[model samples]
Target: MPNKHLFFLLLLTAMALALPSYYFDSNSIRFIFFIGVVAIWRYLWALQHFIRALFFLKVKFKRLRQQEQAIGEIADPKHIFILVTSFRIETDTSILVYKSAIAEAIRLKQPVTIIASIVEPSDERLIKQIFYNSAPPLRVSLKLVRIKGSGKRDGLAVGFRAISNSQVDLESAVVAVVDGDSVLTENCIKNCYRFFSINPKLGALTTNESCELTQSSRTLAIYRRWYNLRFAQRHEFMCSVALSNRVLTLTGRMSMFRGDIVGSSEFIDRIEFDYIDHWRLGRFRFLTGDDKSSWFQILKDGWQMLYVPDVKVLTIEQPPHNNFIKGATLLMVRWFGNMLRANTCARQLPRVVMGSYVWWLLRDQLISIWTSLFGLVLAIMGGLYYGETIFYAFAFWILLTRYLLSALLSTLHGHFSLSWPILLYFSQIYGSMVKIYVLSHMYRQVWTRQKTTLKDSGNRLEHFIRTFGSNIALLGSASIFLTVVAFIAGVLTTYDIQAFISYYFS
Candidate 1:
C-alpha cells in the first residue's frame, strides 16, 4: 500500500509485544528497543507527509483537469526558451533529450536554446552539432552556451548568463530547463504550457522523470530502476500524490520555468543564487544539490511550485563502472551528504523553528541517521556473535522488508516495475553503507581541509571492515555468552527470567 505507515504499525506492534523480554534478558535487546522507537518515529513522519502529499495531489489533479477542459486545445505558446544544462562527462542519451525538446520547440514554434557547458574545456561546437544535426527540422534555431567548470551548479551560472544576455522579454516568454540525459514525453511541454496558460499564479512546473530501462546494460539498467523506485518515484509521489500541498521544489532534471520567474531578482537570489562564500573559513567549494536549492529559492520568492506527473521525462542514469561496490559508495555519499547539507541549510534559515515543516524535516533526518547507525551496529554485532550466519540473517530480513515496502509503495501509487524488489533490497542495505561513507567524507572535507578529489575506494573501506568487523565480533561473542548463562540459570531456577534468552536463541 501507499501507506508505509501501515507496515510500520504492524511491525511496531510486534516489537512492542516482545519489548519486555528483550529488556530483561538480552544486552543486545537495547538494539531492538532502539528499533521500536525509530519505527514509531518513522510511522508518524511518513503518515504526516504522505497525507499532505495526497491532499496536494488531489487538488493539483483536479485543477489540471479543469484547465485542460477549459482550454480544449494543445501545443500553444507565444515564446519558449528551452534551457538545457550540462557538465563533466557526456552521455549518449543527450540525443534523446534534444530530440524530445526539439519536438516541443517545433510544436510551439519556439526557438530552443541548448546550454552545453563543458567542465573540462571541451569544444562547444561538438555539443552544438549534436543538437543541431539531431533536430528533426532545420527551421528551429538552437543556441549553444558552453562554460569550462566543475561542480554540480557551475554550469547553471553559464546557462543563466546566456539567458540574460539573450535580452528576451522576461514577462511574457516561458523558459524550460531539462537535463541533458532526460527526454521529455510528447505532451510534457504541452501540459506545462496548458497549466501555465490556465493558472497565472504558477511560477514553475515539474515533470516526473521516467528512467530508461534496458536489458543489455545491466549496471545502468539496475541503477535506473533503483533511482525510479527509490528517489524519483517517492519524490514525484510526494508532490503528485498530495502528501505535501505546496510544491517544495521542481527537480532540475526536467522542469519548466516561467521567464519572469527565472529573470526576476527574487528567484535569482532565492533559487539560483547559492551564495557560498568560498572565502569563508569553513566553506570549501559550492558543492550543491542544484534542484532543491532552486526550489527553496523559488519558495522564498513566494512562487507556487506545481508537479505535473503526467508530464513525463525519460532520464538516463550513469552507474559506477567498478560494479556494485562502487555504485553503492557513490549513491550513499551523494544522497546522505545532500540530505545533511539540506538539513544544515534549513536550520540556518530565519524562522526555521517557527514552522511545523522545519521540525518535520529535522525529525526525518535525525531518525534516518539514527536508524542507519543502529542498523550498522546491530549488523556488526550479529556478525561477530553468530558469525556470518547472524549478519546474513539480519541483512536478509532488512532487505526483504525494505523491498516489500518499496515495491508495494510503487505498485499502489503507480509506475510498476519488476526490478522494484531487487533494486529496493540493494538500495536499502548498500544505500546505508554508502551514506556512512559520504557523511564521513563530508565531515573530513569540512574539518580536515581534505580535497573533494580524494578517492574513498581503498583506505576507507579497509578501515571500515577492520574496525566494524572487530566491534561486531566482540559484541556478538559477549551477547552469545550472556544468552547461554541466562538459559542455564532458567533451567536450574523455577522463576528464571529466560524469555529474552529464548527469544535471542530462537
Candidate 2:
C-alpha cells in the first residue's frame, strides 16, 4: 500500500532537473558539486527506505492472506487492555475515543479491560458515562484511575500499575495505550492482534494516524491540515524503517504493546522517571516524550517493534498557541528536544540492538540541521551576487520538487492539497531552524498542550541562565555567522555592480 519507492524516484527526478538549472554554469560548479554530494546522501537514504518498504509490502501481503484464511476460524481470545490517559482533554474527543475503543473491543470478540486515567474528576465522570452507555455484545470491564493534576507520566504510571495488578494473562494479553484525543478505527484492534498472533517476536506495534484540526481560522486550518498530511508522509517512512525491526519513535498518539511489556515495573519506572545525564545540567528528568521512553525500554529489552500501516487512529489536533507560527515553533521545540535527548543514549547502544538504519538516522539528525542552514545561506548569497536568476532557479526548484512530491504522496495517502507544497518549504526551512534551536536547548521540556511547564534544571537561577543565556548567545552567534558568511560569499562570487548598472542603463 505504501508508494515509498515511487515517491523517491519521482523526487529524485525532480531534484535532478532542478539541480542542473541552478548549477549548470561554471561560476556555480563548486556549489553544484557540494549539493551533488548532499543529493547523493539524500538519494541513498531514499533508496534504503524504498528497499525496506518493498520488503515490508511483500511480507505484509503474504501475512494478510494467511490472516484472512484464519479469520473465519474462532481463535482463542487474548485479554485486551486499553489504557486511555487524559489531562484536560476535550470532552468531545474523550467521548469519541471511548466509543471507538469499546466498538473495537467488541469487534475483536475478546475479554477487554479499559483503564481510564484522568486528572480531572469531571473527565472521569464523563468518560464513565460514555463507557456505560456503550451497548457492545461482549462485557467490557472499566477501571477508573484518578490522579492529581501532575503530568502525563504520572497519569500513565497510575494506569500501568492498575493493568499490572489486574488478572490479565501476561504472555498473550495485549495493552493498547491510546491517547484521549485519538479515536481508534474499527479494524485497529483486529489488525494489531493478527500481527501479534503471527509474529511472536513482535514486542510492540504502533498504527498509522490521521489528524482532525479544530481550528476556525481558514489560514490556521490549512496549516494544521497540511501539517498533518506531512505527518502521514513521516509515518510511511517510519513504517519502512520498521521492516528492519526499527522505528525512529513509538508515537504516543496510539501505540500497542504486549501486556507483559506494559505491566513490567521497568516500563512504568522509565515512563515516570526517565532522564538523561546532561553534561551541563547533570542528571535531568524527562518531562515529556513518554513515547520515546517506552521505545527506549523496548529497544533495550531486545524486543522487535513494528509499524502496522493498515491500522489507523484519528487524533484531534489543536494548536498550542494562538499564532500559527508560534504554535508550530513551540511544538517543534518539544518534539526535537525529546528526540535529541533520547538520541543521546540511543547512539551509545550497539548497532545490533538498534539496527544500522536507526544509527544512521541518529547521525543524520545531527548532520541535517547544519546542512540545511548552509544550503539556505548559500542560495541567498548566490542570489545576492550571481544575479536573481540563480535565486529564481532555486525557488522554482523547491516549488516544483515539493509540489510534485506532495502530489504524488497525496495520490498514495489521499491527503494532498495545493497548499501542501508551500507548507513543505516552510517545514524544511522553518522547521530546520526550530530543530537547531531545540538541539541547543535539549534540557528544556514543556507540555504545551496541557499548559504545563517544567524547569530545565533544578535551581531556578541556573535554569533561567541556561535557557535564556543559551538562546541569546545562539541568536548573537547566528547573526554574526550569517553576516560574515554572506559577505564572504558575495566577495568570492565576484559580483560586478558596474556591469549590472551598465546593463540596466543600456
Q: Rate the local accuracy (lDDT) of all candidates.
A: 0.57, 0.76
**Candidate that would win on TM-score:** 2
The lDDT, on a scale of 0 to 1, for candidate 2 is: 0.76
C-alpha lDDT of residue 479 in model 2: 75
Error of 1 at 114 (Å): 4.6
TM agreement with the true structure for every prediction: 0.68, 0.86
Summarize candidate 2's per-residue lDDT along 434-504 as a digit string, tens digits: 87677667776788789787744357887777778668756876776576556556544225646666789
Worst 10 contiguous positions by lDDT, candidate 1: 443-452
**Model 1 agreement with the true structure over 210-248: per-residue lDDT tens digits:** 665432455765565566676644563446333232354
Instruction: Please list all clashing residue pairs in model 2, or write none if there are none.
Output: none
